[model samples]
Target chain A: MGATIGRSIQCGGHRTLWASQGRSRETRQRAEAEGFEEVTALVDLCAQSDVIVSVCPPHAAAQLAEQVAGTGYGGVYVDANAIPPALAGRIGELIVGAGGGYVDGSIIGPPARASGSTRVYLSGTGAASVAELFDAGAADAVVLDGFFTSASALKMVYAAYTKGSAALLLSVLGGARSLRVDEALRLEWAMSIPELPARSDRLLEYSGRKAWRFEGEMRFISETFESAGLPGGFHSAAAEIYRRLGGQADESFPVAHEQTLTDLLAGAEPAPFDPTR
Target chain B: MGATIGRSIQCGGHRTLWASQGRSRETRQRAEAEGFEEVTALVDLCAQSDVIVSVCPPHAAAQLAEQVAGTGYGGVYVDANAIPPALAGRIGELIVGAGGGYVDGSIIGPPARASGSTRVYLSGTGAASVAELFDAGAADAVVLDGFFTSASALKMVYAAYTKGSAALLLSVLGGARSLRVDEALRLEWAMSIPELPARSDRLLEYSGRKAWRFEGEMRFISETFESAGLPGGFHSAAAEIYRRLGGQADESFPVAHEQTLTDLLAGAEPAPFDPTR
Candidate 1:
């Protein structure tokens, strides 16, 4: 932890390092390799840096916020994860209770040498600077106006749109293939869609592999949608598709850039959910 | 109906006229102009022609065979439509009931300039002459193997696979667009299918217009799946998407082919459910 702090100061590297999941092995290794300091808890991280980010699993988001509630922390704690907004609100409440800043930060894109097809939606008190944070190269984030949970809520909605839809396509197409009507169905799809095949190849491949994440995400949607008094069946069905895809959750997400996806979908492997096979 | 049948011979000009969907006005006029006496209905068409064929709307294929029950019409009744064998059995039952021969025929490939995308799958009963029928160039129909309506069933099954999957993709993509996460969602999709955009474009331009038919077809699927006593929600949902696209259904079903499908789909349009904006 001290070593990472020293590195941050010495090289003006990552100004703040708050690992909400309690310094995962990967985090520890990367922190050590990058010569940055790692704080043990949110209180410690909040005390040390202006930015206290939570980049943990979705389920743990709210719990992490409460961990630092006793401290009179006033710095920004960004919930930078894939959680829905309802969960984000609990975190928001915890941080506000502690006099700390809570920013609903939902990362849709990835940060790497090869940029991923991801985005970050942030709301809550510290949102304005949250968007500026990416500009200063501190992190990749976006802060939009809404409640703390709104961004995450919006994120869940978006994920439902993408992941859930993918599962739907896969199921019907698979049925079609089993019936040996794939070509005619493809034509019918083509006839019906006019140009959807162009966009479909990539999405299908991604959905086939990411069924697990979608499965988990779908649960969140089911809760959110049902709580909002709407039918939760949409998300429930999505959960089925992803959970059944087996280990694709362990597989890396699809590449975001056009060239990479083009190479993949055009190759012999065929797109994931495309039932044209 | 008799007049149309009589005209097919004139339109066809010395060639065997399998008034599959009856005759187009031009075909009818020409057939009559060609001076061959026309016959009415499948029974007469079979008894009089060197070979008999039975073609109907892809959806009513099973029912089309039901039209020929107990006729004792000896010539082969080529079942060329989209359907499944389980349903095809009904057709075979009807043919054998009448002591008439039946052949399973699935048509594949897009029709040549003189044809449509009418490849055939032949199964059961009279496979040889069925093959000969296509060789005889009955509206450019091709033949596959097996019995009765298997070919048509294969067609429907194939349609289910391709179209259903594509429809599924479009629905999800549309949701992504609605969420304003199209970029990120698309990136995710592309990683799985590079050919997605082109496919999507094609769907919008072509299939979106024809998607209306899918709603009715989905009803069939819903029943098919439900008959197995499982949830038929997928088909029902698919039907919803097609219906939601609405207003694209034109009253433009080609006159000659309209009768065959009008009763099946309830309303045959050139393009009934266009989804693209």
Candidate 2:
């Protein structure tokens, strides 16, 4: 996502700078290869760029926002990470307190590598300006007419069925495997509920390599639901399902290391519940 | 199920008697309507019928078997209920100790009201003999080559997904409703996962009136999975979802009292968990 945005900004005739202080060497190389100027010091990057976009795992969203805010940057800050509304609001306060304009952004589809499927939704007063930064036709960045947390809320709810259902399917299949009647259950499904056989296969294909990434997202989603006064047990269990299938290839498409539904249910251990995670 | 078996027995030129000692007036009337001769005493029913089939809720299966065994029933006893294997084994012991031949039977699909789509899987030494009682093509009563608990095990595992997935989807939608994102979530599912839009509708339709019946089945499935060393939280949570839906009209097809997904998540309160239930 970062590389896509960097290439888009370069195509729009704007200088793009990335702060690679604690990032991997591969990430630095990818940013450089995408025509992004690399700056080791956060202060230098903060001074050079007019706008900054933070895209990382949900757990790191708040810490990254704080690091960027601590640099006393007064530019527009866009957070395009999967996070809850309350957390986005808190991050909004962090960035706004440091005299920076805050824009809550969420990436709905896949990364804009070659285009066509991604929509970057933005909210807040700085949203339109931030959307224009990536308006190079590689991706669609739309400005929503709402406050800071609206984009985050949309993302959280959107994933409740998208990635959330994956966990539900995994839990049911895993439960069947544990009971030693998975094959019989599959046969029964084939006879009556014909949608499940194909749905499970599609879920496995789409989510196998991405399970590791979805763990934290599900955790944040659980928190979002619970904080809204709903039961979070499903997604809490879902996070554990993803955690069981830890450390994937970090790619959207399934690779050789990805596990199918049968292999996932058989190979991975059901991790014990830990709400703190 | 009992009605179908009674009809098949009568069609085969055999007499069928039902023990209606503690049954409701409506059930007795239904049995009479279905051509079953009603006996007010268990001993009388046990003496008259060569084969007795026990079909009830999972919670009452063991108690029903005990009651029949107390009458010193020497005939072949078929326990056809959704229950855990351990409970079935215990019931088998109770019947066998009382000099009665015991057959474990699991009814997959709906009640054998019509001819198609229902299977009666029977297991144990007397399974073949019990299968003979209802082999008149009304329903397929197959004798599985295994111990008494095998049939019950199959039923428990099959329902872990069939009914278990219903609970998962309900919990997710319920969570979204509580978070005030249900409409948004539904719209997203419609736009992205076209299958979920139809699947959610089907789940709501099938589970509306039968939520009361599935509560006990899910509980037994949870116990079966937990006994096999799997996490039982999903089914345990699912049981609560059904419990929230409360009692229904006890019909197979959708009627006037049925609740759609929108009505269910909106009208039904999220009941607190009670493991004792």
Best by lDDT: 2
Model 1 chain B — which ten-residue stretch has the worst lDDT? Answer: B268-277
Model 2 chain A lDDT-worst window of ten? A268-277
Best by TM-score: 2
| TM of chain B, each | 0.64, 0.86
For residue B98, model 1's alpha carbon misses the true position, in angstroms, by 3.9
Candidate 2 lDDT for residue B249: 44
| CA-lDDT, candidates in order | 0.52, 0.72
lDDT per residue (tens digit) for residues B1-277 in model 1: 2223223223444345444356577655755654545565655765675545554444665655666554566656665544445555666667767877667665544432233433445666567555544443324433443234445545554454455555555554444343334465445446545677666656544453556666666666655433322235555555655665545455343322222112223322322212121
Candidate 1 DockQ vs. native: 0.10
Q: On residues A1-277, what C-alpha lDDT tens digit does candidate 1 reach at each position?
A: 2232223223433464644354568667766676455567655676777776666555565666776666777877777666655566666777778787777766554442222333456676668775665543323345654345556656665565556556555544444444444454555446445564655556555654545455677777656544433334556655655555545545566634332222222212321221221
Q: Tens-digit lDDT track for model 2 on A1-277?
A: 7788667667778988888888898898898788788898888898887888888888888988898899898998889899987788888889889989888888877667655567787887778888887777476786765456667877887786667666767666665555455666677678777888887766666665667778899888877766654446667767877776664446456433235544445544442321111
Q: What is the DockQ of each candidate?
A: 0.10, 0.22
RMSD of 1: 10.1
Best by DockQ: 2
